[model samples]
Target: MELKKEFTDLEKSAVKLTVTVSQKDVAAAYAETLGTYVKQAQIPGFRKGHVPANILERKFGEGIKADTVSDIIDKALNEIFENDAEKANRPLPYAEPVMEKMPELDVAKDLSFSLTYDVYPKVDVKNFSGITIKEPQVTIGDKEIDEELKAVQERNAVVIDKKDDEKVEKDNIVTINYAELDENGNEIAGTKREDFVFTAGTDGTFYRIDDDVIGMKKGETKTITKTYAKDDKNESLAGTTKKISVTVTAIKIRNLPALDDELAQDVSEKYKTLDDLKKDIVKNMESAKARRIVEIKNNDLLSQLVEKNPFDIPSSMLNAELENRWYSMAQQFQTTPEQLEKMFSSAKQTKADILKEWAGASEKMLKSRIIVDNLIRARNISVTPEDVETRYKEIADRGGMSVDEVKKHYEDAKAKEYLIDDTKEQKLYDELYKEVKTVKGDAMSFADLFKGESN
Candidate 1:
């Protein structure tokens, strides 16, 4: 047997193997050794197992010969791989080798087959000292705490229809019967609602309500026209400009409880007074702010690191990450791919289009992960059994399940891989804190961080 190897790409190789059929191979009837006839052999025609080997071959010669050829090719390929493991470098059964052409053979000639595959790329870790980036400074302030508390109150606030003579004001709850028609004046399905709530001056809920509705009194009716964004959460009304006739049914305004001990008790029983709550809130707020600052810094630092040490990323992995991100977004928005595409039709962004655009981000994300993984391995990061157990228990507790149940849920290899990756990421962050320089900047409230970004 003779084998030849060729390099087709950085991680791809092709092997051509030629084997001369020996006299012993044919004499021993190697097809029998390959277990093809174990369950089908017969010594005679009287009983199934009574048929003779020569008779079996003569009757099924073509089929048996085909199986014999496959066996020979497989065995020869294994030999070729084992002989050239080191020469191939990073190695595994990468992919099914594409046979460009097969060698022609007769009873007296050698048989040959060509196989091709791709191996894992070899990764080299280097230049760890120069990676640098800017970290955004975030500070949770009294204003942020107040804003969050207000949001909590709003979540708990009740809405009711306004009285017949009541006038609508900013933040005053307004309920109405509304129907929207397209340019044809045909009533659009799903564009009509008998009950919809909008608070004036706050972002108009559902379709944007005009300022004219804000100052209107109850029992009044008006027809308004407006355009809704293509990305609106309401699927049926998005991306459509329609004339809507709305009748002011009633307005129920929210009156927040005074920010005092009562408010403190409403949030949690741990606080006896508003001052006590404020102290705890401020502490929690500061911790949250610090975490946000760390996260921003982390992203900036990693981005810089990736920029400095850029290399070719595996296209397959990048595409996988993009799909994963798209699925995540779809799940968060509580909509299907088709529904989202319909809602955002004007934008021409189907899920596939969005994912294609995100490919670069996905590549960068995976590059960052690769760097973090290298760092973990280089530092010989160790995750204690206790640490895993404690973390598992914490997650289980949050999920309202026992640790054993959580362990059972992670029985698959993929789950274990995720847990290990999480552990490594955490360790990398800790290591980064020690190596990276952090500059303090003027602290900004969480609201300031997200306000312009959200709108």
Candidate 2:
């Protein structure tokens, strides 16, 4: 086949490709298509594979010509794209080539057409060194240690049935049957739960009615009306007013074990004494706080770097990032895209609304990734085979699998490449982290450190 090609650079990291095939190639492809039809031709009046050429053409002339045209175009494009030189000029992986215009198919003349698609943008990362970031100083006080100990005690507490006249109290366990009621006090369908267990005065209890349940005794039934805040975590119930009927089926009290070496032994065999447990808790808390500080610093560094050196992102890549975000959110809800759409419909929200909400964050994430990749290339950061082997060993020990088994899993899932990428990114971040100038800021309490930022 003979062909002529031209490339045109377009805006927003897009390219236009035009190709013209020689008339000789078109005629040859047409003749080849006709020969195949002749050998396989079957007609009513003739034996299979014995139909005359003129009769077959007369019967299926237009269809054969159309198929021939499609075959020729596919072959020509494949040949051009498969060439090493032309392959280098192809579109980005996530963007498909869209036909700009279709040429008229004719065997007597050369074929010409054009396509347009997005390509990877060129980025130059700069000013990544000597960046200043604030690192939070977190201090774990005695109060914090006491709080952690209390949590451990609560986890190990045993539940005992309440007396006949005992009422619900703070920190007591209660099991109840409840249902939501409409304005007219009618039970709403699909809004009822049987044997729901929760601790009084704790966060996340359905309806936040700890005060209302304080005086309710065992086997007592009561109905209460409450209005939830506009920004409630449960979007469906947010800004809504409804009555809920509750029947306390059971009331129980927690018997916390005395805080001592005995309690430490009950909590974990690794703890030899109460002091040992406290030391371990402090070490773990400090390590977690250090990690959080590093995360915040890295985020600040990236944001500053992006601000200093900005570039246009390929629209195709940004759109793909948004799609991945949506898919992940849907997975968390354990539903398909269509079902999620129906859910949003019930909540008076649309897919567009969700996408709009996530657009800014998605774009920022994509931009950060692109910048990091560029920096990795610029700095020549990479992962060695030794790094991969070490990672494999760590995974093997943690998962209780042999190194060879873990290696096989990574290879079978084609995850080794991703592991390499992750290793390279970490290495690059470490290198950048060393150049950062850390400034001492105000101290953050242990509670604030773990509370995290609000959405």
Candidate 3:
């Protein structure tokens, strides 16, 4: 169990650990390993478990040596890393310790091996305080409330099926099947869809082909070449023109309910009148606007902190983050990473190209993350029971749920831990804001500020 250890510094927060075991232990381990093989050996001209060590060596010496070396290294690493000591030197959870070189097992000499692994980079954040950030002022009033009300009314709209002979029209709900064609005007495999429904010019059919589907009656099909803008929201269709054959299957009219107190009551029991709904909408929108402002503040501060504090992100960390982004992009395209590769290949882009394009942003994200972690740890910021309770109450008040219900929703141990950690991080940032100067930037509306927010 006795060992000698040496730590050598490497680039990108990596450390080389050298572990040495005496010749006596190596000889003993070799003997023990040979004995295991001796018990199970079935060499010709020898009885089982009776094969001589020298003969076994001639047959399986290399295998025995490799196994002994692996066992020794595993034991050595376990004894060191399992001590819960030297938190800074610990390997990151996602990164495994890579051996610098595979050592040969020799009973005549001491066992010596080295490992290189990534740890968290030493974070010395600079200029994280006393920075001025622009705080956008967004107005949440009757206009915002009315927009939200309109959405709620839309959700409560009634859909009525039109006659079989009815033709698709603007603002009419239509169900259509569509497929993309290649240069030969043939339907490419895996491009066909059926039973797709959307409101023309409103909900937007597949690829926003509302205009192409209009004026077509049920069971009618037409092939049209549609060109998408360079900045189209759907990345797959952006800057590309494809032939789409759309067949309108059904048409319906959406009847929006009257915007009055009765409609408000039907939407939610908490709103007895239209005025009550408007008041609640205002309150919710204000809360959302405030949350969005805080997010903007945090992002601005983090961006500044990342620039002020420059450090190398461990390659493993950056690679992991880029991998996550790649998978996310694949998900956005509704395809697998393997397929995504082919798609990019067709465009003359390689995986390396995409990863190189994303590396800067990924590294910046990691740097900002490290800064947040270091600041919180240095400040000893944490969440108390009261903090969690207050958060639960706020959520319940906003969602029209009881405090008990909110608590029950987050009752899972992992969920509770996540809540606590999130609250703790927010608390650290809240204290950080005290040293920051917030200046009014520009007047914007709630919708513009929270454009992509789903909730």
Number of the candidate with higher lDDT, 1 or 2: 2
Writing each residue's lDDT as its tens digit, candidate 2 over 311-404 gives 7777888888878877887686555776666655544567788777778877777778878887887889988899999989977865547999
Query: Residues 304-338, candidate 1, lDDT per residue (tens digit)?
Result: 77876766654555656776676676565455645
| Residue 251, candidate 3: C-alpha displacement in angstroms | 3.5
**What TM-scores do the predictions have?**
0.63, 0.75, 0.88
**Top of the candidates by TM-score:** 3
Count clashing residue pairs per candidate: 10, 0, 0
- Residue 161 error for model 1, in Å? 5.7
lDDT: worst 10-residue window of model 1: 10-19
Indicate whether candidate 1 or candidate 2 has the larger TM-score: 2
**lDDT of prediction 2:** 0.80
- Candidate 2 total steric clashes: 0
Better of 1 and 3 by lDDT: 3
Q: Over 4 Å off in model 2, which ranges?
A: 1-14, 21-25, 53-55, 72-96, 119-122, 127-131, 154-200, 205-258, 266-268, 312-327, 330-347, 389-416, 434-437, 453-455
Model 3 ranges with Cα > 4 A deviation: 44-47, 93-97, 189-198, 202-207, 228-239, 332-335, 340-357, 452-455
